[model samples]
Target: MECCREPSCRKRGRWRWRWRRQSGSGVNAEEEHGIKKIILIGTPNVGKSMLFHRLTGIYATISNYPGTTVEVFRGRGSFENQLFEVIDTPGMYSLLPLTEEERVTRALLLAEHPEVLIHVIDARNLEKMLSLTLQLLEAELPVILVVNMMDEAETLGIDIDLAQLEKDLGIPVVATAASKGWGIELLRKRIAEYVRKHGVRKGVG
Candidate 1:
């Protein structure tokens, strides 16, 4: 069996010591300890939520964006002994906000400054989604493109060259069928590897 290296699996006394130091005002525990943040952003009906559930499981904290009615989901996920705080933002077609949800999502992106910005796109609608991916890259955010719903795309005889896409985008790209849990493990491995190399963002306090 693989040995567990999670924070909770550490020595009790050491864990308590670390927890005490991480406890503070304003920031949450994850932020206090410098846990990396992963934000999922994409247009509606792109399997974004399903992908989020696949990464973080069913237990999630649903809360409205501060000072707005737009809801956001936050959950915890562990990959390769690294703990991450994953956030599922509202569907946004573009960085230029039109709807209130889009505005909130954009605001969250700026305020949170996540370490890894995951752009989940529908494999069947690759052309339509590439625009937003370009926008994200232009903004200089660390992004990972998730070509989700590959099964559907395959059904329609749509083929996506993930290797070529990754090469062109200059970032990690993954293919997944979120509903069927395909490529979820590879996604986790990629996330952990990305974080391990790039490290967490500074000034998160």
Candidate 2:
């Protein structure tokens, strides 16, 4: 039985996705509800939705391989009195888009200019995923890397040297097993810190 046939199933890959901007926010993220926008970005099936669900308590299970997210979901989460408007974007491989979903995500980044981009990636596929991370940095977008699915990676005898990665990227990189709830709090802490450092609202001219 193909589970994706159902209306509620998340496996429809790169179809029926829509990008919408919120209304009534004239100010930057830090001022409005102290709402920092944390947009999730990565190639398909890198555990983006799983991290999204873990962060927001929203249920959105995505598929594997050609496993693009079919829709974009937004939700809010808070940590230590700081609130965030978390955005789960359609899965895209790189800053340079090849698909509609990729285009929409890249366009959203330029238009919305979110405070921080959480680029979730599989721990097992770090080398391939780092290219996008480099692109985000090149584009001067504030980004945080979430190295997810560590449990599976460990089982495969794959150990990532995160500190070395941080040194190389010049940005914060977090590890997690979103399915197991490991490294989530640390991710939140890093996010809160990133927002506090970078999400400061500028004075209106």
Candidate 3:
């Protein structure tokens, strides 16, 4: 079932098995009405969807972006008493918009102006993915870094100094293996705290 020679296709195929194991019909009304907005952006196969499911406790509602075939996922979740509207954008390697999917994601980011933007990255490819993080920071967007797939990185003998990475990036960084449910609680805490401190809009009770 090779879709194409693109790396994204291969990665998506590799994780197809996990998709069947997922439960829940999709996002619910409570999750849909969150006051704060959190957008998850990352390259394909970086566990962005898995993290979204974890945060929202439901599968994302997949829909085509306006006037485009590209799909974006949206759901809602609560953390530390803060309700958040979470958007899992299509996989994008850069904000430069080489593909239609990237173009949609780039437009979504600029237009939504979310209270907290979470950039999920593969732990094994940290250095490579940091370029996008830098791009986000350069744009002056509120960003939080999620170093996902730590379990795989550990299996490959990669050790990340999360505190150091957080200091270097000058933003909150959370280490997690979203598939295994590791570090999700901490990630939730960080998201809640970040929003409370920097959120532009007041949370709706």
Candidate 4:
């Protein structure tokens, strides 16, 4: 009965030790402080709320359509033996800002200065959604663009080249169907790595 300050080596009833670092590589000083905060931002019905709930197990009044949640919700989650505060912001279309709720979302990003910004997006509408992704990149924020709702995209016969997208975007791009819990573990691991590292280098995914 031994315990360590890391993930349990018990996947699929087998013991497998996994060491997590601040970056994809090994070793970094940023791991000392742990993950202070992570903010989830996206447009309406992009699964930001769902992914937030899934990550933190905190309910934030989910609905079938948009304009349901007019406020932000914050919760806590633990990954890679590190604790993090997760914030769910109101839907926003772009960083340029327009609606009151959208402005509110932008305000949270500026105010909180989260360690990592998880941009959840609907994969079916990549062209439209990528606009905001571009904006986030322009701001020079540590952003991880999540191409969520992949299942819906598949149903519509919409195929996305994730590797190409990642290369083009110059950031980590994760394809997931948050509703079905696909690619979540990888997302978590990526987030943990970003937090542990000072920040991902520019001009590279």
Q: All candidates' TM-scores? A: 0.84, 0.77, 0.81, 0.74
Write the number of the candidate with greater lDDT, choosing between 3 and 4: 3
Which tens-of-lDDT digit does each residue in 117-173 have in candidate 2?
899899999999888888888888888999999999999999899999999888999
Across 32-114, the per-residue lDDT of candidate 1 in tens digits comes to 35567899999999988998899998867677766788898877788998878788989999999999999988987886768
Off by over 4 Å in 1: 1-32
TM-score of 2: 0.77
Question: Clashing residue pairs, candidate 4?
Answer: 22-196
Q: For each candidate, what is the lDDT? A: 0.82, 0.74, 0.81, 0.73
Clash counts for the predictions, in order: 0, 0, 0, 1
**Model 3 off-target regions past 4 Å?**
1-34, 201-205
**Best-to-worst ranking by TM-score:** 1, 3, 2, 4
Count residue pairs with overlapping backbones in model 1: 0
Per-residue lDDT of candidate 4, residues 23-112 (tens digit): 332323244234367889999899998899778875232221123345657666777876776788888988978887887788778766
Best by TM-score: 1
By descending lDDT, how would the candidates be arranged? 1, 3, 2, 4
List the candidate 2 regions with Cα displacement exceeding 4 Å. 1-33, 59-70, 201-205
Q: Estimate the Cα RMSD of every predicted model relative to the unseen true structure.
A: 7.8, 10.2, 10.8, 11.8
Global CA lDDT computed for model 4: 0.73
